[model samples]
Target chain A: MTTPALEAKGISKRWPRTGAVLADCSLRVERRTVHALIGASGSGKSTLLRCLGLLEPPDAGSILVDGALAVDQGVVAADRSVRRSVGMVFQEPSLFAHLSALANVSLAPHRVLGLDPESARNRACSALDRVHALHLADRRPDELSGGERQRVAIARALAMEPSVLLCDEPTSALDPLLTREVMAVLRELALDAGTTMVVVTHDLDFVAAAADSVDFLHAGRIRISGTADLLGTRGLDDELDRFLQRS
Target chain B: MPRVLAPLLVLLATMAAAADDGMARLRASGIMRWGCDISGGAPFAFPDPSDPDRVIGFEVEIAEELAHRLGVRAERFSADWLALIDALEADRCDLLINGFEVTADRERVVAFSTPYFRYAQQLVVRAEDRDRFTSLADLAGRPIAVLNGSASIESLRSAGVPPSLIVEYDDSLAPFTETILGRVDACLQESFIAQFFAGHDPRLALVDAAFDPGIYAVVVRQGDDDLLASVNAALASMRADGTLGRILQRWGLWSDAQRELGIDRGPIIATIPEAIGTPPEDGLPWSLVLWSLARAAAMTALLTIVSMPIATFVGLLLAIAILHGPKPLSRFCHGYVLLTRGTPLLVQIFLLYYSLPALGAWLGIPELLTWNKVVVGIVCLAANYAAYEAEIHRAALQAIPQSQWDAARALGFTRAQTLRFIIVPQSWRLSLPAIINDLNSLIKDSSLVSMIGVQELLAVALGIGKASFAVPSMLVAAAAFYLVLSLLADWFGQSLERRARTVGTLPEPIHR
Candidate 1:
C-alpha cells in the first residue's frame, strides 16, 4: 500500500494558439522505476512530463510527489519542495556556455543547495564520475562531443541529488549510436543507483530495453497503460500493433 | 499663493534676484569674475607660456586693476570667443572685458566703458614684399587676409581691394598667420595685433599705413549701470596716475591716440617678459607645447573615463527596462532611446549647459539646474551616449539564447539569478565590439565638450595654435593624442574578449 513515487490525475493543458493539447491525462510511477511516456510527435506526451516537473501548470489536475501534494487543480504554491525534489533534463542541449562543464554542473548545488564552493565541486565531480564523464569536466559544452554532452547532462541532473528525474526527449537530438549510449547511462542510473526517471520519447528499441512501465499517449490521453511486456503483446490493440510494425 | 507656501515663494524670489544682479553677487562673493576669450593673443588675455596658469596680458592687468578698485580680486572666466558675449548674457561672468570695441551696434546690447586703448587697421606682408605692398591700395588684386568681423574688411574694401581677393578669418591672428605661411599676399588687421602676432616674426613686417581707427573698451551687460560706472572710474584713475600707460607700454601698445582720452603718454616700447617662455617669433618650445597638450589630453581622458562608466550603467538599466519591465515602461524606454538618438550631441550640450538654467529660472526654481561646466559636460556626455549604449545592450541581452534561461530555471534558479549568472555574461561577449565602437567614437566626441568651454585637447590646440602661430604643428600634435587614446580603448576591449573566450578555441590575433 505504499504510495506511488509520482502520480497525476485528470491533467489538462490548453494553449492559447492550440487549444486543449492535453486533456484529463493520468499516470502513476512507482519508486525507483523507469517509466516511459511514449507517443508520436504532437501527442502531448512532453506536455504531460512538463506538468509533472512543474515546468508548466495543468489547467486542471493534481500532482503528488511521493504521496505529498506538489500541485492541486492548477493551484501551485511558492513550492520549493517540487523544485528541490525534481531535476529536469530538457530536449534541447542546454548548458551555460560561459562556464566549463564542471562549473555548469556545480552551479546549482552551490546556489540552490547552498553548498560551499569546495563541497559543490566535489558533489559535481562524483556525479560526473557516476555517469563516466569525469574526464570532460574542463571542456566547455561547445568542445564536448554529442554523446559526451548527453552524458554530462545526465550527470548535471544527478548532481542535484533529486528523488525524481523528468527528461523530455534527452536522446531526440542524438544519433542511433549516441542514443544507445545515453539510454545505457539512463538504464544504469535506474538499476544500479536506484534513480527514478520519467523519460518522454518515441524510441521503440529504447522502450523495449530500458522501460519498466510504459504509457502510450494518444490524442492527449493515456490510451495504453501497462508494463513494457505489452510491446511484445501487440495483437491486443490495432493501433499498438501498427506502431510496432512501423518501428 | 497659499499661506503655507508664502515663505517658500519669498525665499525663491530672493534667490532669483540674487542670481540676476551680477554686481551684488560679485560683491557678496568678494571676487569680480570677468569673462574674456583667452585666444585673444598677446597683450590682450593670452595665457603666459612659461606658466599658462599665470595669465599675463595688458587686458589681464586692466581687469585686475578694475577688480582692485571695486574692492575684489579678479577671477578670469574663459570661453570660446564667439560665445563670450552669450556667456555674459547668461550671467557666467560679472562683465565682458576682452578688447571689446566701442561700436554703435554693440552699444545696443551691452554698455561700453570709455576706450581703454586705441588702434587702426595696418597692412602686414612678407618681409621681402613689404616695400612692394606698403598700403592697402597696392594689395587690390592680390589675396588679402583680414579679420572677418573687424573694421579691416570695410577698410580694405573702401581702399579698393576686390571682395573676391579678400580672405576672411575669424577674430584671431589667423589672417596674419596665412601671410606668414605664404598662403596670402598680405593681412589687414588692427595695429596692436599686427605688432604682437606677426611683427615679432622676422619673415613678416608691418606697413606704416594705419587706417580705420577704432578704440577698445570694457563691456558690461546693458542695465548693469553700477558695474559700468565702476569700470569707467577705474579706467579714468589708471589713466590719470599713468598705470594704464605703464600697462599698455609694457606690451608695446601705448599710442599717441591716447591724448584724445586726456593722457600725455611716454614713448611706446615692446617689453615681453623674459621669463614668459620665448616669444611667438621663436614659436612655443615643443616641450612646453606638448606638456600643455598632455594636460589637455588628460582632461579629455578623465572626462571619458569618468563619464563612460556612468553611461554604461545607465544604458544597462535602460536596456533591462526595455526588455523586461512592464509594457508602459518598456515603451517609454524605447521612446527615450529614439528621442536621445534623434538629436545632436552638440545641441544637448547647449540645452543642458545654457538653456536649462534659463528654464529653471522661469519655473521659479532658482539655481536648481545650474552646474559647474565640468559637471555639466559629464552629464551631457553620459546622457547622449547612453542612448546608443542602451541599444547595444538590448541586442546583447536578447542574443543570449532562451535555452540557457530555461536551463537555469530548471536548475532551481530564480529569474534574477539566471540573468546575473547565465544571461548577462554571454550577452556581454556578443555586444563587446559594438560597445567598444561606441567607446572609441565617444573618446573623439569628448572634444566636443569644448563647445561648452571645456578646455580639453582640441581647445588647447586652438589656444596654443593662435598664440604660437604654429597652427599646423599644434593641430597635428592634438590629433595624435586622440588617436592614441582610441587605440588604447581598442586594446582594452580585445583583452577582455580574450579573457572570456570559449574554453578550447583560440581567438585570432588582431592584424594591423
Candidate 2:
C-alpha cells in the first residue's frame, strides 16, 4: 500500500574485473516498513542497496521512489529530484572528520535543501534525538566510540528526512555489545519515525530483530523473500544456507 | 780521493744556493702564479664581466708585463683581497697584484716594489652634497663611510678622527651609494675609484680636498730577496724608459695633477717606510667576521619572518589544487614544481633580477626599482623553495587516512570545507621539518643578494677587507656570525617541530 515507498526492478551491476556483483536484483518496501537484505560476503546485497538508494546507479535497472521513476534503462533522468527523498549509510563509518556530529548531520540539509542554519540545526537535533544520540551530537568522529559514531551516522542520514533510508553493513566494525546497541538505536528510529529502510547486512540477529520483511541474496540475485517470521521459521534456502554457513 | 771530495763539495754548494733563491726556483719551475682580486672593483683587478674565470685590470697588466720581462709566462688567480697576503705567505702564489696599498704594516711580512702610482684618498658625496663638507673636521661626529682597511681609514684615524665617525664597509662602492642615500655623510676612497664611480653616477661627485695619498705597489712574499730585487730592477728600467708612463696612460691613471704638478717626470722618489705596527691591518678580517655574523643573523630572521606566511598560504593552496582542483590545474602546479626544482637557485635569482625587467616591460608593468628588485629577489627565492614545500605538504596530506575524507564527505561537507578543516592542519605537522629546512636554506641563499647589489652581510665584510687589508679578521667575523644565526635557527625549528608533534596528538577532528 501507499504505492510501495521505494522499488527496484531488475537492477544489475558489472564492475570491471569483478563482473556481475549484482544481477537482476529487485527489491520493494512498503511505506514505513523495514526491509532487511541478508546475505554472505560478495552476495551483492550491499550493491543492490546502493543501486536502490541512487548513490551508485545500477548498470541496468528501474528505481522508483514514491511511485516516480528515478532511474530507468541504464540512465538517470535529467530531473531525478527523488534523490532528495533517499539517504544512505556506507559500510564504513564515513563520518566527516572535519566536522562534529551535529554539523555533519546538518550540512546536506543546509546546502542541498537550502534550509537556513537555524532550521537545519533544529532538524538535525530532532534526527539525533530519534537515534538517541543527541547527547553526543557535538563530538567529532575520532572522539566517539564505534557505536556512538554509527548512531551519529544514522542520525546524519535521517536528518535529510528521506522517504527511504539505506544502510550498508552499518554495524560491521563495532564489537558485539556496541553492535547490539547500534542495531537497537536503528530499530528504535525505524519504529518511532516510521521511516522506510532497506538494511543490507550479514548479521542474522539484526535481521530477525529489526526487519518486518526479509530477502535472502545469493550470488547477486534475490533468491527468497517473505515475512520475517516465516523466513526465520523455515530458515534459508539450501544455496543461501550453504553460503551463510561458509560465511 | 781528496781531489774528488773537493769537487763534490763545490757541486753541492752551488745546488744549495740556487735552490734557496726563490726567483731562480720560479724560473726553473716555469710556472708563475699571480694573485688578483675578483670582487668586482674594476680597473684594479676584477673578474672579467663576461667571463668569470679570467681577471682583467691595471694590476693584471703590470703583473703580466713584469713576468714577461723575466721571460716566464704568468697565470692569474683571483682571490679575496685580504686573502692575497696569506696566499703569498703560504706559497700559494708567487706575487700579488691586487692594487695592494704600500703601508708600513704590510712591509713586515711582504716585500714591495717601488710605488708605480699614487692615489689620493678623496671623499665622495652626492653631487647635491658636494658642498656638505669643507674639510675632514666637517665630518666629525657624523658617519663617514670608508672601505674597511684602506688608506682613508688610517688617514682618518691618524688625523685623530674618532671611531664613532667612521662607518667601515666591506664593499668599495656601497659607501658611496650609502652616502647618496643619506645613510652616511660621505665615503672616503681612492681618488681613482671615486672618479670611476662618480663618472657613472651623476648624483655623486668627488670632494676636492685630498685626505691622504694611497701609494700602490706590487707585493711578493717576505724572504723572496731575489724576486724582490728582480721586480725593483724591472721597475727602475720602466721608470728610465718611460714605460711606466705608457702603462699609466693606458690605464687612464696619467692624471692631470701628475702633469700639472710635474710629479710624473721627477726623479724616482721612494716614500717606502720601515715596517710598522702590524703586518697588514688585522682589523679588516675581525670586522669582516662581525659583519658576516650580523648579516647571517639578520637574513635568518628576515627570511623566517617573511617566508612562513608565504609558505603556509602557497603550500596550502598548492596541496588543495593538486588534491581537489580541476585536473588541468593540478597538472599545471605539478609542472611548476618540476620546473622550479629542475633549475639552480642562482639562475632563478638572476632571472628575477635581470629578466624580470623585460618581463615587466612586456606586461606593461612599471619598471622595477632597486628596492623592488630586492623584494622580487626574496619572492623568487621563496617561490623556488615553495614548490618543495608544497610537495612536502602534498605528501603529508596523502599520509592522512582516507577514512578522514570519506567521513567529511559523508557529513555533507563540500570538498573545499573538508580540505580546509580536516586535511591542512594535519599536513602542517608533517611538513614542519621540511619547511624549517627550507627556511634555513633561504637565509643562507639570501647572500645571493650581493650579485644584484644588496649590501647584506658578505658584501659588507668584503668592503671592510678591501679597506683594512685585514681580510682574515673580517672573514673570521663573518663565519662566526653565520654560525651563531644558524644555531639559533636550528633551535627555533626544533622547538616548533616539538610543538607540532604535541598539537598533532590531540584527538579532536579539525572542525567543531
What is the TM-score of each predicted model, taking all chains together? 0.84, 0.59
Q: Which candidate number would show the highest lDDT if scored against the true structure?
A: 1
- The 10-residue segment with the lowest total lDDT in model 1 chain B: B503-512
TM-score of chain A of each: 0.96, 0.93
For candidate 1, the per-residue lDDT at B109 reads 57
List, residue by residue over B165-221, the lDDT tens digit for candidate 1.
889886567787688788998888888788777765788898986878988888887
Clashes of 2: 24
DockQ of each: 0.33, 0.10
Counting clashing residue pairs in each candidate, in order, gives 0, 24
Alpha-carbon deviation at A58 in model 1, angstroms: 5.1
Candidate 2 segments exceeding 4 Å error: A1-5, A52-57, A62-85, A98-127, A135-140, A233-236, A243-247, B1-296, B359-371, B410-412, B425-429, B457-512
* Model 1 lDDT at residue B24: 71
Cα lDDT for residue B85, candidate 1: 60
Per-residue CA lDDT of model 2 for B178-247, tens digit only, reads 8878999888888877765554567877777665676778888666788888888876666556666566
Which runs in model 1 stand beyond 4 Å of their true positions? A1-6, A9-20, A56-81, A219-221, B1-20, B40-43, B49-54, B89-91, B101-114, B118-171, B175-191, B194-215, B221-225, B255-283, B355-370, B502-512
